[model samples]
Target: MDFQLIFLSVPLIFIAYKLFNRLRFKLPPGPRPLPVFGNLYDIKPVLVRCFTEWSQQYGPIFSVYLGSHLNVVVNNAALAKEVLKDNDQQLANRNRTKTIEKFSKNGMDLIWSDYGPHYVKVRKLCTLELFSAKRLDALRPIREDEVTSMVESIFKDCSAPENKGKALMLREYLGMMAFLHITRLTFGKRFMNNEGIIDGQGQELKGILNDAIKLGTKKSLAEYLPWFRFLFKAENEALAEHDSRADHFTKKIMEEHTIARKKTGDTKNHFVDALLTLQKQYDLSQDTIIGLLWDMISAGMDTTTITVEWAMAELVRNPRVQKKIQEELDQVVGTERLMTESDISNLPYLQCVIKECFRMHPPTPLMLPHKANANVKIGGYDIPKGATVSVNVWALARDPAVWKDPLEFRPERFFEMDVDMKGTDYRLLPFGSGRRICPGAQLAINLVTSMVGHMLHNFTWTPPAGVRVEDIDMMEQPGTVTYMKTPLEAVPTPRLAAHLFRRVAVGNV
Candidate 1:
């Protein structure tokens, strides 16, 4: 009888605590949460779309509960500024999930590190050393070479008589270029050749990346119900295996680099060489170095592909936009030569198109969840300490109140207003804002701009035969990174001089 009473009292006390907190704080308006489960069951898989729908009813600033965890979502530009700027430091912490903790090695890396001295040190390394303009300029040849290789491959496929007039998988070439470009930049060698044949080392790296994605997407009940984590041993084991594989692969590459450095007595231009060279100076741990290197691969590689693929899809769907870009490309960079990174500045329309793509289809629609370091007020509502805060970037970009004809795919909109995407402007934040804005924004911009410029300058993209421009689907796949629901395929007719389609060999650094 006493035991039964104790169990009943425990639940009663828990209920009272929850009620007291609710009455004490003026939380933002949101759908009523259920006991224990909260709003977890109500959420759709596509988080951005669901959040946007909720924001319509609850207003710009609202709250929701994912299980026991409270999440405050800010939807519009004004609230975005409040959370990202006004309360930047208080809300600068990262809300790490089980997978994120494993992959980031519990905040040993730059992306997932909590706000503090360690974060400050790593961020400084990134800004001052890893992604400096001088380094990017030195690596320009790799970027140009990869783009040219892609152009050469596409030209061959399109010009082949057997494949004439057939639609080509644009993602295939773009993915290859992104993969090779990132591998070379980080590891100092191309793991795969142009023929899509990968070496043994490439295979290991590819497997590790694929497994990492799988682990990230695979849901774990333990993530939501912390008390039940002890029962979910399988998920933890899988993450452990994934981490081990990554460590093995990265360490082997490091060993090879160390040996080569000793023989040559000179450091290479890749990230691995740089990190090893600067490791002692920065007092970075081995785990931190590995984490930073993988951070670059995971963050840099897929995002570049996703952006260019979206840009190409938009260009194919809008012939007028594509033609306009081509005209600009031809004017700035004639058909006699291939468009280079140096000529990107001369083409204003292309810049507008890239900006428009970022606005319409941001690579990460919901910027990685930001955590409130302390109880704070945003938009006059309480954001409790330790609450997960997210900015619905998708909704912010599509707000009709902010953008004119927000649904339309128009690059010319950027021409009317000069908006800075590098964190300053609240209206457009593809790279996010404040202290946590992506450090590699400039590198991503250069690569995307270069890839799009070359593709448009070399060929005209159109929907497959029998498929009208209106029929191309623009629906998004739901994930941390937004990809087109349907992989983009378009027919390419070569527009450049045949001789210019040849790939130029670039020296490996």
Candidate 2:
């Protein structure tokens, strides 16, 4: 009986292997995938590097497998334009990962939800109610206030004798500035007062929010293999616990604001207040509100912050480009006051610099994964309805065919060029293209322009006394968004202070 069972199992195993091979679908030629796990092990840890490398070998478009999952990457401007834009509706849905599906409260957040009624409604709310141009203008003062706070903080640091002489980690400071500003915009209160930060606990809220952003985005084994998810179920429980704490904090702030609004009957519109109103109008669940706020926190804090850091790093690396930008800022925005949104419109050189930054360092590198709703053909290859489509914005921007001297940081490329970063020209979409583009596009751009302008106008930056310009650590680290592998630390020499002859002594704190 045992011999017969063993003999029977041999053929069964053979048949199973054959079946798995047969199930393999035709895809664009890529590195050969192994059995069961497919090409999962072959893909690089940094997705941008993998895509950039693969595009070289596979032409503009290629197909690869991720543990049996099919992902089609569009690496050129023409394909990205034709496929992601011209044929958008057919591929409008987000590629639902097991993890995104689970944590999104069963497909609730804007990023994970499919292209249907739910997505449409949420998009409309965000576009019309939350982030409209008029609404953004109304919120401008809040952003200005935040930038002012940041400049003040920098000034204080520069003034401190113990801290004055040392190079400051501008990336860390910029990230915290972005976070606190976003949080204040949402909560409509200075939760982290200036004194609080000075007292060693002011930035704690920003620190917690940053921690949550990192946690939520950290790639997990469960994301790739569903069967092994039970092994790290503790992560899910921990995330939920963190969510509860975040929710409590948000809800408490909302409650206080709501009570004050009711008492005074003042109907001043703020983001949190607007969301509560949305809750009533849409009959949104409590979890939905919390989840949506979490999305705002995560997206707002990380992407915008990383983008600004990249822009600054690029500026620091290319002094000629940086000088041109400062020249524009000086002409458009004089020394009497800080740069504002009104000045952003006339600063073409500055705008070009920002676009160049996007070209070099797109926040996502690969725009969020989009799923095909029905079978479609891109680049003569038939992609099934359920397959995942990734628009390699990073690769597309850097493709030598599309960009002249693609690797060099050149903002002057856009000096007279028609390609804007507004997603209209698919050749250079930083915020993404089609319906899935970032809703925070306008606000993000405005904030970046204002901040960058302010930085250039206020200070002249340099590498530390001994560090060579070429040796400034430009290495990149992998994350949901790329940051300098080593943080951007620079010695900020105040131009105005230097002119006055009061030497800002650099010291190690």
Candidate 3:
């Protein structure tokens, strides 16, 4: 090797020796890692599945390294509760990564932010303005209105002259509807055209945010080693292009709203208006307002879309469960013109369906990484300050000790148990737990339930032509939020003609 190469290699080798020898960690059980890159290779093929398998061998608590980053995986429900709730104050902080920080509009957004005064303020604002019961009720009409349009759109697409009566792409339709409603709530205006077609504005926004999310979630080589920054230049370019589009998207909304507020001078009601008021009161930057709004859109759209799709997928796979849920809906709702949040309590089976979806296909299998503020003891194992911690929510939800037939999707499990999505019940933490738990939980659940319930009530679903129930691709793809590699495409036929399909397929109640 050349002199310069030898000189550089010597320090790297020495540092690797030092990290291996001097950096002592009394961590929980996990696969042994290499000199620099830790258990990253092991997690490459279906991370949640691999982690669950490891938990079976390593016990509830374990540690793994992603290069220099430390990840502590909690597999047991009890310890998960302890870390996410009882000791939340100590564990509320998030690890700031170059990619995530850049993705969060330079950290003005709360989801990627460390727990602090700013994050606290944003969380309180969201809870009071967007998630409050009154706000949710006011938005019920928005959902009803949107779902009606969605149903009509589906009818049009499926019955089109050229379609030959083929089934529509139900998953994409649901995702777009969810995005539009959430966008309206966040910005007080619709991003799509009058006919619900995504306008140019909508496409620009979605394209950018989707690309940014994809890049931000990807495991970059540079993320593991700071010195290897050049490796991700292409990703960085793509990220910047998408970030610019998102910036333009948010800016357009802000400009229009600012002009409207100037004319009306009333700022009493909207979520963004409230934030603008806070910006003045708290001496915050205008960028913070723009940043936070974009934060809500990005965070809300992906997870909600995935949940709706997965719920539908499960419903298609299990006809008995589908029928049971519809029976509950019929009994509770009974040809109701519209469904609302108030209907949730009366339809326990429907709630169970949503709960079971959360358990089986959580949007984020491993929640956003949390950082230890100080040295801590977890399940009798020592974790040093600054280690990146990940609670294996996927593994915990499917743990045999916590749920019967953990691998199966059974809503009855919730009926038999009191597990809840709130931070308190560690057994079912789809939206996560503690301070970092999804601020949009209430809004998200309401949206998911309303959309899924109405769609099922209106039509019955079946696997597409030549696709068998057993042949459905349950295989998941790798991402921060795990999703089916293939979208679930099914023929949605009206339930009134159920007997017509008796020879062909069955749908879950």
- A best-first ranking of the candidates according to their lDDT comes to 1, 3, 2
The residue-level lDDT of candidate 2 at 448 comes to 85
Q: For each candidate, what is the lDDT?
A: 0.90, 0.74, 0.75
Report the lDDT tens digits of candidate 3 across residue range 1-509: 69689557754774675366335766777777654566667675677777777878888787777765678888778888778876687787878767776667567777877788988887777777657887677666676666666766665666566864465666678777777766776777666665556777777767776777677667787787665667688877876777677777777777877888899776634467667767766656766777788777777777887888889889999988888877887777765444555788888898899989988899998887888887787888777778777888888888777689987878998879888786668887888888988877887888888878877776777788878887878877777887788888888766533222111111110
Off by over 4 Å in 3: 1-23, 161-165, 266-270, 496-509
When summed lDDT is taken over every stretch of 10 residues in candidate 1, the lowest stretch is: 6-15
**TM value for model 3:** 0.90
Candidate with the greatest lDDT versus the true structure: 1
lDDT of 2 by residue, 1-509 (tens): 99688656654654565355336544566676554455678887778788879888977788786655678888888888767777799898877665565456666877778889888877888888878787787777777777766666676687679877678888767876776677766666555543634222334555556556666568776666554567787777866766566666767777887897789876445677778877778767766666666667767877777888888878777889888887888788776666677888999999888888888888888888889998787887767778788888888888777789999999889875778787888778888888888898888888988888777878877777787777876666776577777888777766544332221221111
> What is every candidate's alpha-carbon RMSD to the true fold?
2.0, 5.1, 5.2
Clashing pairs in 1: none
| Model 3: number of backbone collisions | 7
Clashes of each: 0, 7, 7
Question: Which order, best to worst by TM-score?
Answer: 1, 3, 2
TM-score of 2: 0.89
Off by over 4 Å in 2: 1-25, 198-211, 497-509
lDDT of 1 at 60: 91
